[model samples]
Target chain A: MTASRFSPRRLAATFSLGLALASGAAFAANEQYFPLQSYRVGPYAAGGTGFFGGFIDYMQLINARDGGVNGVKLTWSECETEYVVEKGVECYERLKKGLNGAPAAATNPLSVGIAYATLERSTADKIPLITINHGRTDSTDGSVFPYVFPLQLNPYSEVSAIVNYIGQKAGGLDKLKGKKIVTLYHGSPYGKETIPILDILAKKYGFSVTHIEVPHPGTEQQSQWLNIRRIKPEWVILRGWGVMNPVALKTAAKTGFPADRVIGNIWSNSEDDAAPAGDAAKGFISITTHPAGTDFPVLKDIDKQVVKAGKGNLQDPKRFGNVYYNLGVVNGILNVEAVRIAQAKFGKRPLSGEEVRWGFEHLNIDNKRLQELGAVGLVQNLKLSCADHEGGGAVRFQQWDGARWKVISDWVQADRALLRPIIEKSAAAYAKEKGITPRNCAKEG
Target chain B: MDFFLEVLIGGLLAGVMYSMVAIGFVLIFKASGVFNFAQGSMVLFAALTFVSLLERGFAFWSAFAATLASMLVLAWAIERGVLRHLVNRPPITLFMATLGVSFIIEGLAQLLWGAQVHGLELGIKDEPLEFGGVLLSSFDLFAAGTAAALVLALSLLFSRTRIGLSLRAVADDPLAALSVGIRLQRIWGVVWAVAGFVSLVAGLLWGARLGVQFSLSLVVLKALPVLIIGGFSSIGGAIVGGLIVGASEKLAEVYVGPLIGDGLENWFPYVLALLFLLVRPAGLFGERAIERV
Candidate 1:
């Protein structure tokens, strides 16, 4: 087999075969293609595997069990980013549409930096970018961020809930006066997103706030935890990512800061983070919008249809009902529900990017609706609208018991009324800087 | 004063941990003239293999033995497949080859052991021991003990063993050692095996602290500066260099970091190593490569 044997004729024939196979797999009438930006390889891969795995498992189960979103099968493909912003955008440009030339129904940039990077492009592409538990805090303002949806909770609302929960823990908001609060944050845009909101709440409630930054891939946090020791703050708000969360718990224990006194943001709430830290993470508190555990009615179906059928992507079945996994399931449900709602108006055919965008804006997953979907206690009632992309979701605090996470607090709404001016202010600043014309939803609706 | 002592003590403990990995690099570089940039990836692979075996119902001791056996095989394979071919190559070429090896090993480790994070408990209680009002991590003290024992064993091996003498000769002059009829390839194999053993120790310690995952390999980046400050081919220098980098970075972060919005621990080590290079051109222990032109 010399070079003379590999003729152009043979090359053309092979090329034609590949093209024919690719074209044959083109757009179907009742199938909605989704492009999921996943980071299965990276420093944060521990969280990525469980979250993306669970999300993918849920989406696959829906196709296998219920056949899809109202007879329209969901199709999706993943591009690895390793959580790098540039790679995320590269993935977006490559996967913005499928082989059919039709744009994807929605894009989920799970990383905050990716969400921010994709915000402008998604709007220009007329595709909905869902940043479920992350993204810019101001993206909560639907008027400014029309194409972007931070569905469950934006950073602002999420941190506000943490502050409100802290108030509850102290007996009352009035008692929060003169209390010392510490914000141990990952030194990134995602971690810093909660700082301004904390400052706002701290001032309004008369609590003093001190925020310490933890550098990325934060496998060590001795200095910051020791600072917490010196400051002796009553509460520590841990806005961490990946390994930082567990290190924070361990350092806190070593510093004699009670794990119960430290509250983590949603990103730090995963079993991946706590499980590694072992007993040091016991009594560690974090916020959540979705319920954790395998006892959920939806997971039962997922187990039978997805896991039993060998369709689930989980490496270990033990991770089936963990925090990040459940969050992935919730994220999958949210995307599916939006598609189902879009199908209501856009006919029984495949939904377009615009129709799905409309669906995300008008989604109403109330408790009763959740009950009907077999997600009874798994989801809280969410009502996203033209002006509120975040749906004003409530957050519950969960504490890590030795082996598992258990809910420790009732659902609490963020001090949203106090946060309204701040949200609008930041959104207005973002609009001005980006020269984005804020949509008049009152007129458009 | 207690606060200062605590910070100082914490930094030294961390330095000891970093040296555990740095020594792995020194062993190979000293004997084979290869930087072995894959040292971190090797650590990660060793830990991942050991823990993954434990997850599969192997007892801890059996899993550990299997991991060591795997490392032994790995060292032989590297010598036979890669290093044997690249013998006497330019230093940069050998270095680049090891980088490629690192990528391959990282991918293989993740593939063979699964990409999920696994908790590796050495059953060493992590509670900090208190003395007068200062706290010291017991696990770190245990790590220091491990480091000390390994140092003693390595000292004895280098001073008394026949193979160790041949390795020193090879390091002194490869051509001369070849003229003297020493099997240069076999020494390279032995050097890589020793590196592999040191890597396993470093991996288990770090994996116990940070858990066994793909990111465990990134510790190599940290070990590079330790090698620079300590000398590329001196095991004793690696220990001292790790301590200096570790303690100074911690103290800098605590005392000077907050003044500059903090997070100096990330770059302080590199800057310190760079400054140290001004004083010790060949590192604190590295030999100067001189030509009698």
Candidate 2:
């Protein structure tokens, strides 16, 4: 036994194992891990792949150019959710623990259903769960949703921004008086989330609005379009998703409604939604937090550094600067900036999930920072706090011209003053229901 | 009255599309008692293959031929790799197997062609065509014509061919047909290939309408009520059942839906299907099952 222990092979193997363990520890100490609950195959896979691909590509760019943010390397692993809520929860449970003893930076599920399902679990785990442009409207109050970030815009803000844009087009809010509008929405909680907000806005602006629902998956919408023809509203707000968007545009055409009069919401604004409708989708406009196209300096850098080097995550190069991909890149920028902000407060090593949550709450990316990041006009200026999770209540409008989207408006800010009170009321109600004592952001400041 | 007629006509035209999908199910069910749950995946697979090819610069006819070949190959693989192994399995077992196959095919379709939405152009503009004060979609009219031609061809194949006779015999009783020297495997293979062809047609039309994406497979949900109302075993039943489901659901969504909160088209067909099941489980044109219990 003694002679065996002293063997040359055994000694070499032990030495190698020790060296590997030491390096692994060193690697873990200097890394910020992001647990990506990504979907690459499902009904929503097109959106998922583009978004996650953009996100991963942005992170890859960071690693390639900056060698990590402040000497802390960015690392991530994806757990495919297929856009299913249960699968998302499973992914959350599987990946809440960071890799190789590194603390997880955050979780970006990208699905509203998954985000809602894991809200409590994410809070309990003390990890930040980022829902870029969609989530519960009440979750905007970071006091109650400390671990959840609705990022740039929440549901209420999205509708408000659209209404504001509509107002801007109508000459003024007062001019919208007596004007009739119809909202064709998907039949889900997400689609219904803005109903009250729209109603409030309608009443406030002296406009009459009609709401029509399209069932889930929304394939056949002839009846709804026929009804829209009957109503003859001046504008049709298409609050749709997946196959519903193109179907709405096509049906609107069949029903003799001008495509230019249809205003798609954030989810309905993608090239995937417009291109399918062909000529019917011409001149169709939608709201966006970020514009599509690789003309932005950030996108050009990504194409040059990440994609050209074969380190890009997009399976199809055609989707490199599409709407969803741009949203993902914007999302990646926000997440990384949050980590950088947190590192400034706490030391520059791999921080825990709670520390990262604080970073997200304090995320402030103004026009100066956007310019510095070479993401001007690509991402809206955002400033988050414990009282407000959705910092950027603004959107730009774009129109589809048969082949691609052309930005048609500058950043149109939502009436956040009008929306803030409503957001607080809902958040307060939620806090009372959950028996949660709201955080004192004043003291945190 | 004109508005009502418009809704009714639009719905009936839409029903033709549902009938197109149901025809694929009817083909498989009539020949082999298996429900072939992978039919939707086949549609997605075919459309994805065709559009991906088109994007890669394949001509229209060339892409169509290649997609048809792929579907036929898929039919052969399903018969050999799946249905062949479970020749005499229970209907439930076959259904479960096909359900598993559906997931595999969906994954494989996305894996083979990257998960990206591609707009399919069939060259038929979806512009409105007015007829007697009622506006109808020209594209929908083209779809209706295609459906009519497909149904007629399928009807002829089943009624006026020796292979059709063998298929009918096998459908009636596999053991008896096998004893009489009707190659059951060959009939199953032929029926599946024909179903595959139907899926290609359905896929092209649907892909053109909805864009070729993962959601293309979700049209299966729309066919469920049609199948239930028409009975899974009859192609003609599928057409009649589709018309009933389509027109009634649209009319309901427009007229009755407002009274009971709208968006009833999705589930109203299921209600009608349930009523049909209660009254006539064999469907309008389906043969009555004479099982000796």
Q: lDDT winner among the candidates? A: 2
Q: How many clashes show up per model?
A: 0, 0
Task: Return the TM-score for chain B, candidate 1.
Answer: 0.98
Error of 1 at A433 (Å): 1.9
Candidate 2: which stretches are off by over 4 Å?
Answer: A1-28
Q: For model 2, how does the per-residue alpha-carbon lDDT over B174-290 read when each residue is reduced to its tens digit? A: 889999999988998999899999999999999989888888888888898899888889998899988988899999999998899988889999888888889998788777879
Clashing residue pairs found in predicted model 2: none
Give the Å error, residue A98, model 2.
0.3
Native interface contact recovery, all models = 0.34, 0.84
Tell me the interface RMSD of model 2, in angstroms.
0.8
Task: Please name the candidate that would achieve the greatest TM-score relative to the true structure.
Answer: 2
